[model samples]
Target chain A: MYSSVSKGFALLVLVLMNCIMFSAKAANGITVSTEINFSAQPQQCVTLHQGRDCFATILIQWQRPTSQTICLFHVNKKQATSKKQLMCWPESKAGQANIEFESSDNLTYQLRTQLDDRLLAETEIIVSWLHKNTRRRRWRLF
Target chain B: MFTKPINPNIINRLFIYSIVAIAFFIAATTHASPEEQSLTTHGNTPITKDAFEWQFMLDMALVNSPVMLTDVEQTELWDYVQLGLLFDISYKGFFLRTNSRRSSTILGGEELGYQITVQKDWQLDVILKAYIEGFDPIEILDDQNKDIPELVGLNNREYTSGIALRYSRYFENAIFYIDIASARASENEQGHSATGIIIDSFYSYLIPYRNWDIYLGAGLTYYEKALMDYYIGINADEVSSARPFHIADSTFRAQLEVYAQYPLSQSWSFNAGITQSFYSNSIKRSPIIDKNKLTQLMVGVLYVF
Candidate 1:
């Protein structure tokens, strides 16, 4: 069982590395981003004392290989006719929103780069929830 | 001006208000956690996410220091390489991590154990740790109190296992650490067993300037008498002919460490750290002690994935 698991792990790592490499290259030329992150998280209490008076947050951040203007929009099935643009060209690098369950129900998000009013590249993005955000622990030595 | 009478009730109410206010202040100033990051995917192939993370790291350094924490007098500098593997599997807020540290020395500094992380952000952890304690042979009665024999038969190294509680927090540029452990002798066939509690606290500050990072840290450590005696104390049976029955009490120690790193790129960095330690009087008064200060230096490169 362990052997098979190890093999699977190796394969997964190879794929992840390839994806990262491709992403880097794509960001440089005509690709959408060098790196990007779109996520949803429960609003966390930033204090020692904990409480459940928390909501949810949607955040998006991206980097360009070169300075190119991109536009991003957030829409939801509940408001099918509304096109809530989160960012415009140049300023569309990052955006965040505090939301509720109804706000995220069937939400649609997309990123596109434009050149002289012409769309050059476009991609739909899906934001997934992470169990928690991890902070790097300090290294210790004996 | 007329002086008002002291009202204890107002002071009491004011104190409660201040505490609540401070709690709110602390909560407001805290930073967002990054332990679990939500991922955004392009309309392409689905990315597979794993539940476990495994990393292999090697730390090689040149150090001229004592053979052991208690053996402070050894001034000979030796170069050593330390290789380590860190395997962490985390889900939700719970995690289990197994660490392997391998080194080359007569007094092995290798450790193999698993630590259960019950909580990360609040900085609480329960750990089981095992390590080798090294020692040097005691020389003949150099500072004779009267009539004492030269040391003959003595143990050189021992293994110890312990349950430790660790608390850590990284606030802005400084990190705080506190670890307390209760340990007992393990795998000792010579009827040499000891148990005691150990407490240590460290405060370290990080300074990042462009591509260079510097760190300065200070810590305090306390050891129970049982633990100190087993390492530095002399036994009754071993105190004959030319040796005297000597004992060591609980000891305290202080340390200062300075480290710096330069990131050459995203995957590679060069780092160096030096540390100095001062021993307590209880340990200094031990019969075999020759030096009170111990210094260590390490320089190496690190790679990350």
Candidate 2:
């Protein structure tokens, strides 16, 4: 009876650990938020060579449990001074915006409450490349 | 620009230096032979999706050049348009490419060739080339549109083809080429004797500013007895008092050229270049050759499809 009880306890611990791991995995692309949920359609942009500019059209969507005045912002995390408001919805439960992004680095989009400027949810767009920026050998045009 | 004729002593010194450079390259290649064997074992990189490609381009140029056929000293302005096609196909390490038109600044004017082997920065190729163009007797006209007496009775020397082996080294901002060929003149009624060896070498460097590519190049060409004789020598059958029979000896020619190119868009570009050639004594002394030197200037545009 004592051994059986110990085994049961171990199984219970294993189940709790798995639950915590899966919850973290679910939060990988999303920010835990009580007021709003936000996401972008394409999570990444790829270019031909490193250091080249990547252009992409991003669709940002957000929803909340109740109506609230919220604003959407485009942010460049590398440059702290680069944060611009894209659009704002007045007393709406959900909102969507299309943005044209041209950048060489990753960028972030933030959804915040306009009332007190409190952060609610955020998502990121990553940049990737196929080839390094080494000198390419031109076969002909010499 | 050559203000005065080059002295024979300077020519001899330059020739010696060129020989030394050639020897050095041969020796270096021999020393690297072992590495080449190992590299061959690795095979080529995996093929990519865009490995086969082709392009067609139309080129038109306005040219100003000195006429080299008669004793009369004259320069003429002319324009021409040429259709060019380039096909590039590569599988593994082997490649075949068309050379319908090369850069005006390059020493080798145009040739069709294929790569034989490549090791690191060095590549070897075999090409079919023509270094000289033939002219008809009627093509040589005086200012009055009359056939010049000097060329009236002479037979046409048809354009010839040669087989050449070329070795090249490439760098980030510079390139070097060396070619050795066995050339023969085309059969014609002139009964010309033609079969000889030719050697040519060129070195070019690029200087880029903004979106422009500016190139400066220098080259040397050596012509052996049979090739030189066929072009400049007056055959015994056609010998006259006015055109005495002449035997041409081996000769050398030196060239310097500069070219600049600017891209207007993805498929259009502008180019301009100037080339000057200095002939050696054997070539200058030919009765048909009026000037010991020649200069050509050209400006052109190209459209790619």
Candidate 3:
């Protein structure tokens, strides 16, 4: 009866730990030791014309000193009021994701703690253009 | 032996061919789209690499004083609604482009060409384009089948397309272009073809004002004897007392244009333009020529993709 009671206690502990991890409530369990470094490859998206939508496959990477649960949010600097959570990861030290991005304006990719929504690391995708007018030239040769 | 008669509306066939070329070129260029785009965006982005790009536009315009009429009998002012679908497709070093304008639409205004070289601010290209648009008298008559007195016996001038070498210089707010072309006309019913040499030059300046781009441009064209004679000259056998046999000489024509474009959305735009063309004495002296000057006004909406 004592062994069964010990097993039940262990099961309950495991369940509690899982709940704490998933619910992002491990605020006192572990602390970030060092700075979180985040970056995105192909940092700039370029279109042929100024008004065209720029498209690119962005490679997002982040590294932390210790394993921790965090989520990524995409924020458009033009519309600061709206922020979208792209993805979240279970306790991990380093992670990378490939995302297809298409937008007319610049976008910011941010990494933050899921528990307190504290900003950790952020990178920006700069949008640029080659020509001012979209291929519609006024060549009126009569 | 019976023979097929020549169609006076041969320019329509040429326009249709140009439309087909636009479609074919657009399809061909799209084959090198994103799949072939290199992902070497490391430091700085190189804008024009080995890329395939396309833009499709639908343009409609209300034109005043159409230039298609060559008759001396019709003196009343007439208005016309012109519609055109234009396309620009580029791949590697070649491009096919079309422009929709009031006077040029009678024969499809297309430039099929390959970019030979692009220097710091200069570009050179080899192109195939139609220099002169043909006119159909039947279509211009009061009725479809009725023949106008002035055009009863006049032979229709067939549109001419030719090889051209174009040189362009880009400036901060303007551009200058010069073209030298050897235009070739299709064989007539008499089994004879004509070739003419032409030199054209134009300058366009852009003015930016409150989300609108206004362009002021001027152009000059030098036509050779063969082209002028074939289109405007009257032949001996087909000449009457009213239209005596006459020969045309090489001439220069001048034109001025003011054009503006406003963007309504990311993919849509509105454009309006006015053009005035003045003929020289050489062109005015042609037996069939009616007017010394032509004026046109056009407004259009464009959707780009």
Candidate 4:
């Protein structure tokens, strides 16, 4: 009877230690941090001459934790139009991801990121025109 | 024999009347149309026709200007200012614009200022501003006696007069603006005199959401050394820790800022931005600058008349 009681006590201690270690590991597992960097490559400011095509390339960088898949969707906030959809898997060696959009219109855009159908982060970029009154129209009453 | 002693009752009546007149003037100026108020406070932006074009903003900022540094070799400096304000405003094409602010004190002193801008399409926009600043000098401590020395001299009051000229253009969902401005500073007896010229080239894109706008741009400012030092803390290190006087060489500054404005209503909005100054080498390497960091966060309100 004494031996059996001792054995039972040792089993309980081992189980409690394992539970604590497992809980500690679970608490620190799988955190995802996302960052978005907007770059107007080759140009800091886009100058749109009146009645001319002002072209610029927008480079986007999405950084995530190692070994996570990130899906990116971009939409023009002003025109309510979608630009492109990008899906990427970032490995430990390739800790960075990238996407690009070519735009000629003056608009603001939103970049959204998701992981396994879970929303991760969002950010915005604003592209402006150079000249005053390039494409503006006066309101006319009908 | 000719002059009679002024009556005490008459003097009191005159004082009361003066107070009432001043109060009336302030109240009238503070209550401006939404369009006129927004233009003055945040410079000028393109107006829209949707009857809902407007901006709202909140800002917190820190500024250091070394206007006075007596010893160029020693790292003593003076002149620092900080700001916090909430602003709101509205605009419609070129017809009407208004701006207003509720300001707070952080580093330097307390101030409240407002402006109005009126435009007629792409042709012309006129701006008028009235501002007042109160300052308390930063004090430095002495090692031996535990006494503090005032870094800023007397003359802690500032009155500002400002005017601006604006030209505008419109794109698909954005309005572009170019503004030329001049502001004069009236300082108290101990304060330094300053005149500033500001050239602002701004471009703002209207978001699909109602009353949301984003802007990015750069500015070039040329100011007298005294003005620059007083505002930018150029030679703060040369001032003596025991005394309050320092001299600074004239300086020029250029900065880049990216900001967004959101309007909560016709009369109120929020604005926030990040500004980084590209300082002149002389100013950047000055011994008086402790950290030599050039980044600032600007948050403020947009109040439309």
Report the lDDT tens digits of candidate 3 across residue range B80-187.
454556666667656767753523433346677887765547778898877776654444553333444656666656667789999988887788888899987766
**Chain A TM-score vs. truth, each candidate:** 0.35, 0.75, 0.70, 0.43
lDDT per residue, candidate 2, B1-305, as tens digits? 11111112233433543354344434443543221122333456322211222233455656554556655433232212222333232322333333323322111234545566654567777866665545555444433255456666876675556789988788877778878999887677756648888897877787764445677878888888888778777887767656778888888888888877665543456878787778786665666665667887667776544
lDDT of 4 by residue, A23-104 (tens): 4322212112333232223222232222233334445444533445555556555565555565544342122333343444
- In DockQ terms, which candidate is top? 3
Per-residue lDDT tens digits for candidate 1, residues B1-305, read 00001112234433543454344334423522323333334654332222333333344555444433332232223214333322334333333333212232111222222333323333556655553243324321222223222334654335455677877676777878777888775434467888888787787887754335577888887878887788767777667554467798987778888877664432356778887777786665655554556676667775543
Regions of model 4 farther than 4 Å from truth: A1-142, B1-123, B130-135, B139-160, B205-213, B229-250, B260-272, B285-293, B298-305
Clash pairs detected, candidate 2: none
RMSD in Å for candidate 3, one decimal? 15.6
Could you tell me which residue pairs clash in candidate 3? none
lDDT of 3 by residue, A11-103 (tens): 457446645544432232221224676767776665535655677788888788888888999999789686899999889888899988888
> Which candidate leads in TM-score?
3
List ranges where model 2 is wrong by over 4 Å.
Answer: A1-142, B1-51, B72-110, B142-144
Ranking of all candidate structures by their TM-score, best first: 3, 2, 1, 4
Error of 1 at A32 (Å): 19
* lDDT tens per residue, model 4, B1-305: 00001112223433543354345344544653333222332554543321222222233333222222222111222111222232222223222221211222111111112213224344445544432232333222121123223333422334444566656665666656655667666664564557665444445454432224555555544445544445434233425554334454555556656666554432345656675555455653433333322555545553433
What is the C-alpha lDDT profile of model 1 across A1-142, one tens digit per residue? 1222453465456446545644643421222433444333321211100111222344444454455566666555457686565666564555445433223233445555545533323332222211112343443433
In terms of lDDT, the poorest run of 10 residues in model 3 chain B is: B1-10
Model 2: DockQ vs. true structure? 0.03
